[model samples]
Target: MHRVRVLPKYLSKRLDRWRSTTFSENREWFSHLASHGQHPRAMFISCCDSRVDPVAMFEGEPGDFFLVRNVANLVPPCAVNRELHGTSAAIEYAVLVLGVSHIVIMGHSGCGGVAACYDKCEGVNAEWEKNTSFISQWIEVLAPGYERIKDMDGDRSERLSAFEKEGVKVSLENLLTFPFVRAAVEEGRLVLHGVWADIGSGALFAYDGSTESFVEV
Candidate 1:
């Protein structure tokens, strides 16, 4: 029989601390939430990067945001398919069921997924990203954004940063294609936001639809 590995002692200790302290301090709130269910105000879609902490970025409490983290923070246009679609399913639940008023697509600087998409679209032939790999296929969703900036007159890093923000634009546009999302927004019940973070400096940029550019927030 294959034995299941237990949580590491050190990591388990962290949970113990939370249970003993954090959970204890918020026991009443926890009990209420457990009974009433989550009613988050926002749905935050972000890149699955270790440095980009959605909670920390927003100083959020538990159940404050319906969070979905995926590669490059890319949102594919709404599709009905038999194949398992974790990202799309989460968005549907958040928008249609949870009734979240805000959808924030958060991307960040120095994102590895963005870099992979840039390289793949640029035909760099990276060995780590075989075309058949799951990551390769997932990152392909950002290919259009990469293609948009792959030839722009800038250094590789600058172009990569542009690509990251472009991914946010793509996601925001894609979110509207969902009928539920569009209905909610049109009824003045929902708002969409695009955010990019400079991971190195801990700075955030918000998309300004006015200028079609990101500005420091």
Candidate 2:
């Protein structure tokens, strides 16, 4: 027989509170969403950072964005392999099935994942890297940007900040490597956007293609 444990007391309390305040207050909206499948306009790819709340930052409502979060907001070049690729799968679904008009890769300042790449460059072991080592593999997507930024003149902090933005650009490029994404973008069916969040000041900057740089939004 299978068994299921009850939610912890604190977690149950939290759930009840959320239901009362957020869910119950919008029961009709939630019901409509449950009846009709989601058709979000954008796919928001962001880092798995607690402080980086894509919905709140963008003032998005439920079903507004097809969201995918991962370390450093990294998106690997599309590849077909036996191994399961969760991020790529999300991208495929968002593009092919959901038909999201835009894909936004949002990176942020003081990102711990980006910091880990600097650690790798400095030959320092990130705590998670030592035990699982999968983190290193995942962070590998940002490796090229780290290599470019690390050698640049400036303090380590400045280099890391530059890398955080560079990581967004890298992900944007990687998105193009996906055939479906590339086709959609080429045919004017979709748009690719790169954004960086200044976590401390709550400011967002978007990559401007003409300048090849991020500008304040």
Clashes of each: 0, 0
lDDT of 1 by residue, 1-217 (tens): 4687889999999999999998999999999999999999998999889989989878999879999998888898888988778888998999889989899999999999888888888888675368578888888777778767867898998999899999999888888889988998999989999999998899999999889999999
Scored by CA lDDT, what does every candidate get?
Answer: 0.89, 0.91
TM-score of each: 0.95, 0.93
Q: Which stretches of candidate 2 lie over 4 Å from their true place?
A: 1-5, 126-132
lDDT of 2 by residue, 1-217 (tens): 2587888999999999999999999999999999998999999999999999999988999999999999899999999999889999999999999999999999999999998877886777656467468887788888888777777889978988899999999998899999999999999999999999999999999999889999999
Which pairs clash in the backbone of model 1? none
lDDT score for residue 180 of model 1: 87
- TM-score of model 1 vs. true structure: 0.95
Error of 2 at 62 (Å): 1.2
**Superposition error at 216 for model 1 (Å):** 0.7
